[model samples]
Target chain A: MAASALSPIRIDDPADPRIAGFVSIKERDLTGRQGRFIAEGTVVLRMLAAAHHAGRGLAAEAILLLESRVAGVEAIVREFPAEVPVYVAAAPVFDAIAGFNMHRGVLALGRRDGVSGRDALIASLPASSLVLAACGISNHDNMGSLFRNAAAFGVDAVLMDETSCDPMYRKAIRVSVGSVLTVPFAREGSAASLIERLQHEGFAIWGLSPAGETDIGGIPPAARTALLVGTEGEGLPPAILESVRTARIRQRPGLDSLNVSMAAGIALHQVALINDRI
Target chain B: MAASALSPIRIDDPADPRIAGFVSIKERDLTGRQGRFIAEGTVVLRMLAAAHHAGRGLAAEAILLLESRVAGVEAIVREFPAEVPVYVAAAPVFDAIAGFNMHRGVLALGRRDGVSGRDALIASLPASSLVLAACGISNHDNMGSLFRNAAAFGVDAVLMDETSCDPMYRKAIRVSVGSVLTVPFAREGSAASLIERLQHEGFAIWGLSPAGETDIGGIPPAARTALLVGTEGEGLPPAILESVRTARIRQRPGLDSLNVSMAAGIALHQVALINDRI
Candidate 1:
């Protein structure tokens, strides 16, 4: 399953600048690259390859695999274009380069082509589309889980505020199970701007909060719907909640709100128009 | 809010035997206590205190709080009966005791009163109740997230497989946001046995797998239903999937499957009789 036009490169030096993107992964996680992200594990690597092949602006600049793991992922690695280099490192060198155990044995550096274009993406949604928008979702795992839910319900796109965490964060991508690689997302503008823009596009924006006025289950379906999710503890802000229709998942009282990702999934499933999706 | 009957004792040494349960917190996370578990944060502490007051097995043995955070959580501490000791530690001492930076600044040693009784809990379920059964869920966070969803949807109880991770795992409890404290669970039998028992109890046993033969949304609501969620990759095993009524959350074809917790939430929202719950 090896690619004929390109052969795997051997990475031996821990200080090699060619592998700079993969070094100190924990620290790099805190400070992301210009427009690049790391996709770890076999599943996420495959997703990166798929996104690269789809010509969707995501490109695999290079791939680093454990010497022992190459055979297992040969088919997936072969799917990448010949120009993308696959680097194989001995287990010890790989771990040293990554600054951790790096047990998953697979890592790929992926770069998104361009800058944020929230308004353009908002303006481009077709009529009768389902979208998920988030405000102040600063947690990486939460953002990743949200993307996974959005993808499962066939959300057309995920829109987040400037304050939201990057969907490309490594932990977020891992938690998403590579859904971050598959789903399209835009992170720009304020939460209010996203709501106003969706409303302008004739999309019904529903803010999901525990104190919402309407039950999410019975909310009437609309042609184009946007499910708005917020951070776990402090849900959609008051002005944002009041700016759009607010709906709460029907749940037992006395406890705090549902975890944000669970709430997103429930809300998405309700308004997702399943027949059109699956 | 200074629990008049009990006073907070100042703790200066991390090596004190009185707080043995709280030391080596990380290692203790892997190897659990005989019947004790640590509950962190103000929210979980409140739940543990509530469970203690209700005399439902869970009792707060002792508490450790950062000196700075003691005042903010005094109301919750006072809720605990006078018998439970409250310990205050300087910030440095508390962090040293936890083996990490303990930012939330609250930890309580909670003890379950007795051993596992899976059959007893199943027997006690109301004629019309929603339940969640987990099979092969080894990941602590997933178990924790499942419990959180169960609590949010008002599930009567969570019955897990013998192989599933313990809900009382420190990370699991924290991820569950103390739902593990409030929600009752039993992990005593094989997944097949759990399913079989639920079926015998006149409950609708639905195995949630991506390969499920039935669509989750259109399934008619039942007086009682049990939603089964398996591990992330290899979902409900073949025999178990075949043994119960199989239902799939409709999703786009290209993706593999939804995160188990998200799937559980979506499925529970559809099958749960929300109006009757709250």
Candidate 2:
């Protein structure tokens, strides 16, 4: 069988300019990469390749792989346009370039510049939609899990407030298991304004909090529904919780609240089941 | 106000024999800890203190605290018996002893000799019970989350197979928000035997998997119900999945499965709500 139409470019130097975008990934994770982000592992690479092939607003800028892995992902690599370079390196070079041990040995540069705008995404939602909105979720793992849950439950779109970290962050993307690439999400504005816009669009928004008055399961399914989650310790701001209808997952009387992402999954599952969207 | 009835001892040396149990915590995590385990942060320390006071079969052997955090956790420290030594150190000494940055400034060595055996714990469950069983759940974070979810949903007891990782692992306890200390759990036997024993106890078991035949929400609530989840990618071993009545959280057709912990939370919440436990 043929290896494929795509050519593999060998990279021996950790300092190779061709693989610059993939360098010092851990350090680059903290500093913004303009419009580019890193996608790692074969699973995520497959997702990015599929998204690019399907023209789903994300494009693969390039790919870096351990030479041994090139054969395994040839089918996925072939999905990318010919212009997108695929670089392979030895273990030492890969480790040195990434500034850490990357056992997975697969990385890709991606562009989110084509992501839809918040208003545009909101306007594009169907009349009957199930959506997820995150507020003040700064943890990358939580952010990724939120997207993964949203995708698993077939949420129509995700809206993030300004205080929330980028789901495109490397760890978040890895946590989301590449749902970040396929899930349509827009990050802009403050939590309050985002809530206001969703309300204006005639969506019933339910902020998830321990103090929530209504049981999440008891919430009546609506034509358009959105589940809002906040940061871990301090839940949704009191005002925001008050502004929207609130739902709680009942728990034992004296325990710390469930992890933010865990709560999101439960709430999303409940809403999706009631709405017949799952 | 008086700081506490118990006195604090100061230790300047990182290698102090008295603090051996708390040394190189990261490395110790890999080595078998015998009956000893490390609990960090004020939250877990408080949980340990309470567990010890309640005669829950767990005890705080000793505590190591940064000098600065003593005031904040004075009440918690006081919860421990007067005989338990409390050691205080400066920041550098504390970090050196821990073999890492000890930002939380609190640590406790605990013993879990009192945890009930699987059969004993199972026999102790009330006539009506909601329990969570884990199969091949090796990741500490997921294990922690499972216990957290179990506690939140008012599960009676958690049963883990021999193949599962210890819930007492330092990171798991922290990730569980100290649920591991409070929740009653027994790790023993193989997955098949655990299921068989639960079935013999008249508990209707639901193994959570993507291939599960019934929607999780559709499972009829039973007087004794147990929810079982496996590792992330492999899910429940095929033999185990086939051996038990299976249920799934309905998700999008083609996406990857939800993180095992997230899936557990969703299933637990569903069963808890149905059983009127939460």
Candidate 3:
């Protein structure tokens, strides 16, 4: 293996042009060019590297480590199949540029792919697949957790509706433990239209609504299914509810509803169980 | 009606002793004392007021709000039944005292309840009640989310084993949306002892193990069941697994495991479904 050479670049000034990608952490939408998606801590960095190696297109363009964090970064870099650029800077300078307290002492910048459209996602999935359709879920963490659960429960793809937050958002990626990078996902149109299309394509669209008439267990183990989840305060839109075959995870009378992500996790697991029966 | 008996006192001093409870943000041991729990934001304050109205014994000992945030605080106090003390301080002083940015600009110190031991929790529950037993879950947010799910799914009580984090931590309370305060919970002995006790009390102990032989959906609905959840990285301990009948949430073959909180949510919802069938 020719040592795919990557030199360690030293950054002495916070305003150094090479370190511009790290500034202004608060402004996630900088220049609208899919700004650097940051992954902190060794575990997350290793996951990013692994995804990159597995042809998931998660290659980190640059690795930033504080002077004291060089050892940890070196250990992580040893596992990477490709030699990526490493940047070393003073702790204070790094903190100033990063705009936050650098607890993990290591951060990586990676190019983000454009959000996949619904057609692209549908084309990539098997005929009979378990899918999680997230609609109107605005909380980035919740969105990330839903994707993470989808990955864990073997959902073939995660389809997001128009109102759903971007899965590539920094917080979403961090919360998903980098599963967002590995999992196939795309943004569909409106929830109602998507449900209609899925139903037409022989996908049993089970809206995970609290007010649904059918119990979640009574879904009759379909060959192909999609679990649709809504936001926290408001559940599925009335239009979507009316169009899809509704199912609910039964709960006690007094409790209002489960947290959106929690509900998604339960529904995804149940769907996986039903799929296994087939 | 009574001219709002609780008058707002303005304080500009950061060293004011009246706000000592709000000063130590990072010190957990200090917050364990009575009159130490801090509730931030208007939503939580509203929930606290509602809990107080419901005679749940959550009374704000003192309220602190930034001068600019006076209107929101006043609105909350209007709904508060009791004559709770309200204090108005400069935003900088409030932030200095709270040791962080106060986004909601409002904070309250509530009386902390003595967390019941395992014996007390078991004694209080009905013979056929469902309980959630969490073990070795150290993440505060995850524990909080579990409690929220348990409450939503109508679990009788949430019991934390020896290795679990404290449910009353500030982050846990915030993440739980004050559900931790509403839900019945107790920190108890080892998972083994609790499993034995529940079994002796005619409860079916269902340990959630990823590697278990039985699928969660396969378990026949039981009159009284206790769902056991362990930490995310490590599932149930071997001793706990041996003590209880085990069930696994079926997942994709290659995925490692679901987040413990997500798993707890799914399990609670499934148990609730089982209960509904009976």
Candidate 4:
């Protein structure tokens, strides 16, 4: 529990160049990032530290905390690698640097392994695994909730296509309660290739739809099952539905469908229960 | 589908006083209201329209639609009562009136059956019913998703404690895809009284938790069941958990719990399936 890994740096000026990566987070989230993303709140920061501690393809470069929060979170902060810098600033200075009021008072800068990092990570999962895949999930909250569900159900990894929102988006990471850091995820390629690669990996691909021939409840347990979900409005693309085995959640008729994240949660829970992984 | 019930009204000025209720919507949501809330997006507007048509205690007093969207939604417009006015405005004008960019171009001034309306509605549900009880669900998204799941699982009603967020909140209604209008809900009294009243009415209350003894999969079907969910993080208050028969949606150890909405979906689906209602 010793905090040997971090020497708290005092930042008095919000304009200090050292903390520029966190400036104007909302705008930066819209435009792509330069391989860096913000992880907000204490939970997410801990996840980043844990991932870094485990060498699970994500590392924390720095942490910024409101001066008052430092005392409360010091024990957790000490767990990060010694090389990772920790900075503390007054509330005003921290708000100035962040370009908004950050009530959580804890933020971390996370760096993924590389562009192809998630793909390589996915290729390394064990034979018995559960994965939650996102095809066109662009909403940050949906992206985070999906990961949180995946983690709760013990899914091995989360695979996302280019159309999906970044799992590291600050809002997403916060919404996931830092599950984005705990759950492994990769965002690469088109939906077609993502599906093809999973099938080639000896995984059974089950795309969730409202009109599947068989309900998700009856999808007999399997060793490696990849549950595919699409964006909210239009569900999984026609190509993916036709190419993979599609299963419906059996929601009552009349309503369109459940929210994408909720659907994933239900489907993942069923899969985990069926496989006795829970 | 004839729209003889609704007559189109043309609006050229953004500050036509007729649309003041929608101005500065974000702030208005926090302050008080005159039994009115803004319903945005086509899906929610349609729900409002349906509620009005069915005399379900909700009515559309007026509609502010972008002139361009009028033709596309003509079929839906005709479903409303002829007294409900449909106001068409230029996008710029609508944005000015709303004090923000109204991208969806469909906004309706909805008049609910007042605070006591939903309470009376909830009291009127049948002897055999499936209801969703929200104790401390304060998040708008979670509230909306709960309503959406209730609709999907054929839950008869969504009853919220006074601490819960307003289901009529614009974002919640949109997230629920207008299910907030279709499904009956009442946010009144304390969680204790709400549960007591449901118990008095024959509801077998099942509080969802991560530490419960009975697994959600094992919850046998009943004539009347009320699934209770609390806010994220704090979960259901200890008082409620101890008083009711709690059940857990089994998940892997170490993880805290599933998202509130996700848990509701899984539990509702399980209960619905057990009852042979789905």
**What's the TM-score of every candidate structure?**
0.96, 0.97, 0.82, 0.95
> Tens digit of lDDT per residue, candidate 2, span A1-278?
43334568889999899999988989889989988889989889989988887776788898998877888888888878889998888888889988887539889999978667999999999999999998899899999999999999999899999888988899999999999998899999999999999999999999999999899878998999999999878989998988999999899998888889999999998899889997
| Clashing residue pairs found in predicted model 2 | none
**What would the DockQ be for model 3?**
0.54
Query: Who wins the lDDT comparison?
Result: 2
Candidate 3: tens digits of C-alpha lDDT, residues B1-278: 22234467777888888777677565643446553577777767777777666654456677788887776467677676556767778877888877778347877778755545678778788866888988888888898788788777888888888778787677777777777777777776887777878887788888998887777766777778888898778888898788788988777665557788887787777777767722
Model 3: C-alpha RMSD to truth?
A: 4.3
TM-score of 4: 0.95
Which stretches in model 1 have alpha-carbon errors above 4 Å? A1-6, B1-6
Q: What is the TM-score of candidate 3?
A: 0.82
What is the Cα-based lDDT of residue B250 in candidate 2? 92
- Model 3: per-residue Cα lDDT over A1-63, one tens digit each: 122233468889889888787675536533333635777667678878877776644667877
Fnat for candidate 4 (0 to 1) = 0.83
Top candidate (TM-score): 2
Q: Which residue pairs in candidate 3 collide?
A: none
lDDT of 2 at A68: 74
Q: Comparing only chain A of model 3 with the true chain A, what is the TM-score?
A: 0.88
Model 3: residues with Cα > 4 Å off, grouped in runs: A1-35, A53-58, A65-83, A87-106, A114-116, A188-202, B1-31, B41-43, B46-59, B63-83, B86-107, B188-202, B220-223
lDDT of 3 at B131: 89
Model 3, position B13: C-alpha lDDT score? 83
lDDT by residue (B1-278, candidate 2, tens digit) is 44444468888998899999998998889877998888999888989988898787899899999988889999888888888999999999999999987439999999989667999899899999998999888899899989899899999899999999999989999998889999899999998889989999999999999999998878997999999998778999888888889999898899888889998899888888888887
